[model samples]
Target chain A: MARQESLNVSSSPARRRGGRKPTISREQILRAAEKFAPEELSIPALAGSLGVTHAGIYHYFSSRAELVAAIAAHASRQLEPPPPGPWEDWLVEVAFVLRGHFSQFASTADLAAIGTSVTFAPLVEALLRVMRDAGFTIRQAGDASELIASCALGGAVVLQRPNFDAAALVEDLQVAEDSPVHELAASAVDDDADAAFRRRLAVVVAGLKASLEAPTAS
Target chain B: MARQESLNVSSSPARRRGGRKPTISREQILRAAEKFAPEELSIPALAGSLGVTHAGIYHYFSSRAELVAAIAAHASRQLEPPPPGPWEDWLVEVAFVLRGHFSQFASTADLAAIGTSVTFAPLVEALLRVMRDAGFTIRQAGDASELIASCALGGAVVLQRPNFDAAALVEDLQVAEDSPVHELAASAVDDDADAAFRRRLAVVVAGLKASLEAPTAS
Candidate 1:
């Protein structure tokens, strides 16, 4: 073959793409896992769909467990960064970001069922910097971080389950008939979800701020 | 043998006296579920193990879904009530209560996952009442309740995963030259699951509180 012909064969677009290009990435593998979850899926099955060798995929992620860890890391990074400035108002924004992120990747909610304890380090690190500078003591800051991440992740799982839309769940909050307060309580549950989440966040901040400013009576 | 005699013989205390009762209450069924979970378990299997007929199990639960829902509700109610006072302190207590509840029935973590959303209405209502009484607007009370509940439930799940142990996780907070801020910034991959979780939680809560109190500066 002519030099040009050999060059074309060796440096074909497909060959140059990689040693063996697969139509898949770590993200695609995770997406498939999420889509077919609660159903055991094998690397061969994933590779078959991507038209790539199983070994090629394994090159990126050493094993199934590593792939899952990557997916979790993706989720942590996907979350909207916590808003800057004051603690209260931006918390509401963070809630929206969290909710949106969880909703967009419904399957990540399942991973959360297992917990983010095994994945998601960088996100945690970023959050620690934010909290420590905000004046939380080491232990207090630690407790708070655990509390919020758990709520966000677990809440996503809770919200995404069959027959449990976020709005409908909140609507279940009607006040009792015998209570002295009726109209206002009923109205409270009726507020839009965004409004309701922000309102609730504000109360938590108020409580935290109040406690922080004054040493806890406890 | 006469029918009456046979019935009496079957009902005799000796048949049931040495071990768990021959008849299963909802609680017994749920306990069995906890023992059998993350494994393939069904109403019939549970009944067979308890030495009862499937019909008897049906008489109590009517359906497997009902049984699972009841199991979750029972676990959720077992959570200790938050102590009277500030949101931050009470939230920490709430986290501990949920953690305790999950630890006691780790197998049912997936089953009890439902209660984190649907069956939590009563708990959320109580929280809303507390927030309102603390001088938050109805909206603010609702917002705070949602955020706190989500965090507590999510945190509990993280603590209950197969690889996580709360005591060990908490112990990872000791600072070292290689990891100066281990208090709440350790990577989740460490064998020290407790410390990693504590670190992540601290940051999330601090961010959450910070988000709440401040409006985003223009």
Candidate 2:
């Protein structure tokens, strides 16, 4: 795909004026942008890092938002389509893959916010397929897919944060010392975030399954 | 609580050196900090906005991190504790309250990532209480509370983004034009984010109930 994109850029009429056809391609720019994302993903910033003019970068991506969308698309390509299986199993895999993909970049949630659904087409398709296979009507599948996808994306955002020291903060506040809340916070001090993610995914999957089995509301 | 905090500040050794006892209190500082949070929530920013020296703000919040925690705590206080009820009903209310609270602030996810667990203590207690009352063992209650909380926080983050015009973006990409994914994206153009949240919450609640009934794993 990168090679195809590079070829398309090289063949385009917008090639820079007589400068030996700029070496960078859109894929290359997106690669560089991903490396600096969430902090320095702007076009000018990317250009500065690549030793290219800002306009030179624009030849490949028409605007900064386009560039961001491309990077998000690039990152999302990491998610493999789900193999044939029950919808719950498929969703579990999808959640894990998404959590892993988005956790790598600080800007994952931000980029996702701006990214068009095209970037997430494969994952969305897989989710919808599973929901349908699970016997949900098209409307139910659509709503379930959105809900599940949102939960996964949201979970990734929370898990990607630096481990929050609930214990230290509780001590600082000097309140809720003996409360169940304190115990929960204290336990998180040694929490494995990935394991917690899997458990939450299970909850979401379980919920969807139960909802499916329940009689439809009149 | 605000009155007590004021008394503590006025009587402290760090009290402003005999000039007017510095009128602002910690609660006042926290309120101001939250008002500008997620963008201008830093110590220097808060100080500048309050027309006070940086050191003056420190007298209230020992560091920038503390100020962030205080602000998260302040925002969380908006969550009224759920009235006594069935555990599932209680959790549903918790999810809605949290989703509502975080959605109102643009920088909610960012602030939440940095805010300490103490900031979420009250909400956590409420969730744990409900889970326990629902007959989940202590460990189960802890895990379920975390799962439910993550889902709520994550849902809020995803829903808070300006709607991605999925249909428009798909048109721009010009691929998957006739795909189920495309239909899904098109439908999102008019999605009611709140209704979707309720549906997802139902899934999580159902999942938790199922897990509780399942035999304990050895």
TM-score of each candidate structure, all chains considered together: 0.53, 0.72
Candidate 2 interface CA RMSD, Å: 4.3
Model 2 residue-pair collision total: 1
- Model 2 earns a TM-score of 0.72
Question: What's the lDDT for candidate 1?
Answer: 0.50
In candidate 2, what are the lDDT values of residues A33-91, reduced to their tens digit? 88884645787788778876666587778766557656666767556776778787787
Residue pairs clashing in model 2 are A207-B203
lDDT of 2 at B119: 48
Per-residue lDDT tens digits for candidate 1, residues A98-166, read 555544433422333335532334445445556567776655544445544544554455445545344
Put down candidate 2 lDDT per residue, B1-218, tens digits, no spaces.
66755445542335334434455777677778777746456788888888988877766656564455556656675567778887877787877776666555424233333222224567767777777667876667776765555555556556656665667766775755556667667666666777766766777778888888889621
Question: Can you give the lDDT of residue B48 in candidate 1?
Answer: 76
lDDT of 1 by residue, B31-148 (tens): 8775666335687788777786565566567666556556666656555567687765555555555555544433333322443423444555565566556555554454454555
Candidate 2 chain B: worst-modelled 10 consecutive residues by lDDT: B109-118
Clashes per prediction?
A: 38, 1
DockQ of 1: 0.16
